[model samples]
Target: MKRLPNFVQLKEVGPRDGLQNEKKWISTADKIAWINMLSESGVKEIEFTSFVNPKMIPALSDAREVGKQIKREPGVLYSALVPNMKGLEFALDAGIDAASVFMSASETHNQKNINKTIDATYPVLDKVIREAKQAGKLVTGYVSTVFDCPYEGKINPDQVLRVCENLFASGVDDLSLGDTIGTAVPTQVEQLLEVLMKHYPKEKLILHFHDTRGMAIANIMTAMHYGINRFDSTVGGLGGCPYAPGAAGNVATNDVLYLLHGLGIETGIEEKKIQDAGLFIQSKLGKILPSRSLAYFANAQ
Candidate 1:
C-alpha cells in the first residue's frame, strides 16, 4: 500500500524562477500586479523575486521595488533568492519573510552556476543563512542539479547527500532538492529519496522538478507515494535554468493541483484562481505557456 499525504504544500516560484529566464522584460508594475493577484489565490508562500545583481538577471532587476510595493497578505510568506550577504541585505531591506540560498549538487555545475566551487560556496551561503536567521526570517536552501547535470551527467546520490548535509547543518529550515535538468524518472527519484530520507526527515525535504522530458508528474507521484508532500512549482510551467543547458520549465502548479485534487489529496488551493493568474502572466508575456492544465482550464471557461 502506498502512503500519500492527505494535504500538500505548494510553493509558488512563478514570479521568480518562471520569469528569470525570459528575454522580454516584464514591467515592474505588471510584476507587482500579477503577484498581488496571486496573493489572493491561496498559495501560502511565493518566491517573488531574486536579489541577484541586476546585470545577472535583468528580468528581475526590480526585485526591491516589487518586494516593497506588493500588497502582502497576512498569511502569505514572501520570499526571495539571496545569492550572497549583499543580496541578503537587499532582501531584508525589502522586508521579505524568507530568504532562499542556492547551489548545485554537481561540483562542476555548482562552479558553473554559482561561479564558485562547492566547497567555497558553503561559507558564502552560511553567512547569508546566519544573517537571515538572525533577522528573524526563514531560510530555505535550494540544491540544483540533484539528479543530473548538463555538463556532468548522472549525479551520484552521495554528492547530493553531501551538499544537503552541509546546507541543513548551516541552518536552513528546509532543503528544496532540484532535478535541475529534468532528467529524473520515478525510479531515480525513489532511489535518491531512499538515500536522502535516511539522513533527513521527509518533512525537511521539498522536491523541485522540471518537466523537460514530460516526467515531472510521474516523479512527483512517486514522491507523494513515498510520503513527501512539499513541492516547488511555477504557475504556468514558465521557467528554465540559464546555467543548465536545455533545461525546461518547472512542473506547473496548475497541473500539480489538478493531480492532487483528483486523487482526493488536499492542497487548499483553488485551481481556477491559479489558472487565472497563469493566464494573466501568459498574456503579459504575449506567449502561450506550457502548462497543459492551464490551457485546459483556459479553454473550458
Candidate 2:
C-alpha cells in the first residue's frame, strides 16, 4: 500500500474562484465578512478576490475595496487573481501577498476564455509573473483544463507539461493544475503526475479539481499516492467556469478536510470552522451548497 502524506495544505478560493461564477452579485461587505471568517479557520492561504475589470466580472468588481477592507489575519496569506499588468498593479496596490495568473492547456479553450491564443496568453502571463516578482509578491501559475476541456475534448498531457514548464521558467513560486470541467479520472491523474513529478517538486504543485463528475476525491487520492500535498478548494463548492458549460463548482473544502482527517493527514483546519463558513455563504447566497459533508452537518444540526 502506498503511504499517504503526514500533512496537506489547502488554499481556500471561495472568495475569488468560488464567487466569480455566481450570477448573483455578492455585496462587498459580504465578501469581506466571508474572507475574515475564512481567515479565522486556520487556512494558510486564501484567494480573496480577482483584479479584473468590474465590467467583466461584476461579482468581484469590488476587488480593490474587498482587498483593502479585509482584516488581515496573521499567518494567513491573502492572494488575488491577475489577468494582466493592470490587474497586477491593482493587486500590488491592494498589498496582496500573492498574485495568480491563469491560462488553459487547450488552445480553443484558452481562446474562448481569454479571447487570446495560447501563445499570446503566455507573454502576458510571463510579464505578470515578472512584475509580480519585482513587487515582492509570491506568484502562482494556474494551468486550467489540465484534465479535459469543454471545447477540445481530451487535452494532451504533453501540452500540460509544456505550460507548466513555461510557468516555472517565468519564475512562478507555485503551479496549480486545474480539472476545469472535472472530466479527469484517477488513471489519467496518476499518469500525468507520473510525468509532472519527474520535473517539478511535489511541494510546488497544487491540484485544483472540480467535482463535476464526482471524481474529485478519487483524483486527489491518486495525486496523494504521488506525494502531491497541496490542493485548491472552495468553501461550499461555490464556483464554476463561466466559459465551460456544464462545469460545476470546485471540490468542497469541507469534503477535502473530511477525507484528509479520516486518512490521518493533518490540514490544520477545523472542520466546524469550515462548516460555519460554508453555511454562512450558503445562507447569504440563498442557495443550498452541494457539499456532502456540509449537507451532513446541516442534517445533524
Candidate 3:
C-alpha cells in the first residue's frame, strides 16, 4: 500500500452512539464514568450523547445532565447529536463544545429514520448549524447511508455529494459520512470517498461505519487507502444506529488504533486506556465485549 495520512482523528462514540441502542439501560453515573475514562484515554473528540426526545431515544434522555456533570478535558472536543433546534439549544446551554446536525443521503432511510423527507431535513439542519455557529460552538454535518441503505440499497455517489453540499452550505464545520447499514464494501467506500474528496478536503470529512457484516474495519482501511484519516468508532465496538436495522456494533476503538499504530499513523488515542474504558462499560452493560482487541487483552490479563 502507498503511504496513508500522517495523523488520524479518532472520535470515541461509545457513550452516545454506542450505548444508546443497547438492550440494557445504564445508569447516569456509569455513563459519566465511561465518558471520563474515554476522555482520559487521549481521544481528542467524542460524540458524547444525543439531545433527542427522551420518549423516542430514552437511552440518551439524560443528555443534558450528562453534559452538566461530565468534566470536559482541555483540547478535547465533546459533542452531541442535535436533530433540530430544540436539541441544539440543549447541547449549547449544557456547555457542549460542539454539536452534530444530520440527515441521510437515502430518501427512504431518511423518512423511516427521522420521519422527514431529505429535502425537509435540510432546512432544519440549516437552522441548527447556523445557530451553533452563532453560539461559537463547532458544528458537524452527518450524511448517513452514503454507502448504502438496508431499506433502499445501493445509493449513488452523486447522492452523497448533494447531501454534503447542503450541509456545507448550511455552514457546518465539517461533514461526516456514515455507512449506517454496514452494507458498504471497499469499492463503494472508494467511490464515495472519491466524490467527497472532489468536493471536500480530507480535513472536512469523517467516516462512520457499523460492523454488521464484519466489514467495518476493512472499510476503514479502504477509506484510509483513499486518504481518509478521521473516523467514528465505539469502544469495545459498542454502537449501532437505532434507525439502521440489522446494523450493529461500530468498529472498535482499540482495533482501529492498533491498525493505525502498526501503520505508523498518529491517532493520539491510548490503547490501554481505551481497553480499560471498554472493560468498565462492558461490566456495567453486563455483556461480553464485541471487540476482538478488547477480548484479547481481557483474556491475557
Candidate 4:
C-alpha cells in the first residue's frame, strides 16, 4: 500500500467562489460573520472574496468592505482572488495575507471567462505576481479548467503543464489546478498528477475540484495517493463556475474533512464547527446545501 500523508490542508473558498455565482447579493455583515465562523473551524486558509470589477461579478461587490471588516483570526491566512493589477490593488488595500491570480488553460475558456486570450492573460498575472511578491505577500496561481472546459472539453495535460510552469516562472509561490467543471475522473487525475509531479513539487500544488459529476471525492483520493496534501473546498458545497455553464458546487469542506478524519488523516478541522458554518450559510442563502455529510449531520440534530 502506498503511504498516505499524515496531514492535509484545507482552504475554505466559500466566501469567494461559493458566493460569486449566486444571483442574490450576500450582505457584507453576513459575509464577515460566515468568514469569522470559518476562521474558528481550524481551516488554515479562507479565500474571503475576489477583488474584481463589481460589474463583472456584482455578487461580491462588497469585497472591499468584507476584507476590511472581517475579523481576522490569529492563525488563518486570508486570501483574495485578483484578476489583474486593479484587482491586486484592491486586495493590497484590503490587506490580504495572500493574493491568487487566475487564468484558464484552454484558450476558448480563457477568452470566455476573462475576455482575454491565454497569452494576454499571463502578462497581467505576471505583473500581479511580481507586485504581490514585492509587497511581501504570498501569491497563488490558479490554472482553471485544468481537467476539462465547458467551451472546449478535455484539456491536454501538456497545456496544463505549460500554464503551471509559466505561473512558477512568474514567481507564484503556490499553484492550484482547478477541475473547473468537475469533469475529472480518478484515472485522469492520476495520469495528470503523474505528469505534473515531474516538473513541480507536490507540496506547492493544490487541487480544486467541483462535484458536478459526483467524482470530487474519488479524484481527491487519487491525488492523495500521489502525495498531494492541500485541497480547496467550499463550505456547504456552495459554488458553481459562472463562466463554465452547468458546472456544480465545489466539493464541500465538511465532507472532505469527514473523509480525511475517517482515513486517519489530520486536517485539524472540526467537522461539527464546519457543519454549523454550512448550516449558517445555507440558511442565509435560502437554499439547501449539497454536502451529503452536512445534510446527514443536520438531519441527525
The numbered model that scores best in lDDT is 1
Q: Which pairs of residues collide in model 2? A: none
Tens digit of per-residue lDDT, candidate 1, span 232-257: 99998989654555455999999999
Q: Taking the tens digit of each residue's C-alpha lDDT, what string does model 3 give over 216-285?
A: 8899889988888899999988885445454458888978888889889998888999999988987887
**RMSD after Cα superposition, model 2:** 1.8
Q: What lDDT does the true structure give each of the candidates?
A: 0.92, 0.91, 0.86, 0.91
* Lowest lDDT block of 10, candidate 1: 240-249
Question: Please, what are the lDDT tens digits per residue for candidate 4 over residues 1-301?
Answer: 5788999999999999899989867788888998999999999999999998989889999998999999989989999999888898999999899999999999999999899988888888899999999999999999999988898888889999999888999999999999998889998898889889998889999999999999999899989999999999999888965455545699999889989999999998998899999999988877777899988998998
Off-target runs (Cα >4 Å) in candidate 3 are 240-248
Against the true structure, candidate 4 has what lDDT? 0.91
| Ranking of predictions according to lDDT | 1, 2, 4, 3
Q: What is candidate 1's local distance difference test score?
A: 0.92
TM-score-superior candidate, 3 or 4: 4
Clashing pairs in 1: none
Model 4 misplacement above 4 A: 241-247
State, as a TM-score between 0 and 1, how close model 1 is to the true structure. 0.97
